[model samples]
Target: MSAPARRILLVKTALDGHWRGLSVVARALRDAGFHVIMGGMITGPEIVRAAIDEDVDLVGLNVGGHAAVVERIIAELRAARPELPIFAGGVLPPSTCRRLAELGVETYPPGSSLEQIVEAAQRLTGVEAGKA
Candidate 1:
């Protein structure tokens, strides 16, 4: 039997209700053999709790807020699970992307292709594409 798909937690870090970017990335990760858990518009504490409860291999944050909020979530996640791989995508400015990059969270801005994102998931989660 084939191995199980890697699990990914997809969360939005703000009250903003935009779902297009998250939806696309979640779909891409799923197509790449990741079982993505959608966490819509959650707070830092909520994200942390869900991350622990889900037992996912990767955490994908859909950030559409001030970098401070996103940073807080990153910090909390790091504190809770230092080894968990994280990547973010959304309406991020260049400066915000740089900030997140400094925190070891890969940022994918608007217009990032699904193929590239899927490839990134494989690299981040250590799950080879098309093997399962």
Candidate 2:
């Protein structure tokens, strides 16, 4: 029998009110067979609560700015789900990306291809590249 689809929670930690990037990424992950939970432009506490409630396999942060915000969200998620995998994308500067990497969350800044993002999801979630 096939395995159940991995659940991924995608959240925007930035308050910028942008949804295009996260929406597109959600579509890609869903097409790649992930069960995506979209948490739009929420705060740190909300992100943590949703992550816990969803029982997500991975947390994808859509950061528009303020690495500290994303950082705090990462910490909260880790505290709640220590072994859960997390990834981030959207307009991350090199230093912010480096900082997130230091925290063990993969960052996909601009110029990142959809294929690469899909591959990261597969790698982080331990799902085969071509499978759900």
Candidate 3:
């Protein structure tokens, strides 16, 4: 039998309400044959709850604020699910990207391609094309 589709949870870390980037990324992930859950602007607790409730295999964060805030959310997620893989993308400056990188969360800043993001998702989730 075929394996079930790998599920991804995409969330906005801040109340930015910017959907364009997330929309494009979601579409790409969907097209790549992953089940993506769009968790619109939510707090760290909400993100944690959704991550657990949805039983996602990977988490994609759309960051639009200080790196410290994202750090906290990442911490919360790690505490809840130590093995869950997490990645992020947004208007992150070089310094902020480095900060997230230090925390082990891959960052895809502006100008990152949808193909690249999709590849990261596959790698992070261990769901290669035609195999998920």
Candidate 3 per-residue lDDT over residues 1-132, each given as its tens digit: 878889999999988988998999999999889999999999999999999999999999999888889999999999999999999999899999888889999999989998889889889889765554
Q: For model 1, which pairs clash?
A: none
Off by over 4 Å in 1: none
**lDDT tens per residue, model 2, 1-132:** 999999999988877887888888899999999999988878888888898898899989988888888888888888888999999999899999999999999999988989999999999999888886
Poorest lDDT segment (10 consecutive residues) of candidate 1: 123-132
Off by over 4 Å in 3: none
Q: Pick the candidate with the highest lDDT.
A: 3
Clash number by candidate, in order: 0, 0, 0
lDDT of each: 0.87, 0.89, 0.91
- Model 2 stretches with alpha carbons more than 4 Å out: none
Candidate ranking under lDDT, highest first, comes to 3, 2, 1
TM-score of 2: 0.96
Q: Write the per-residue lDDT of candidate 1 for residues 13-131, one digit (tens) a residue.
A: 88999787788788877776789899888889999999999998889988888999999999999999999999988989999999999998898898888888888888898867764
RMSD of 2: 0.9
User: Candidate 2: lDDT of 55?
Assistant: 89
TM-score of every prediction relative to native: 0.95, 0.96, 0.96
Task: State in Å the error of residue 57, model 2.
Answer: 0.2
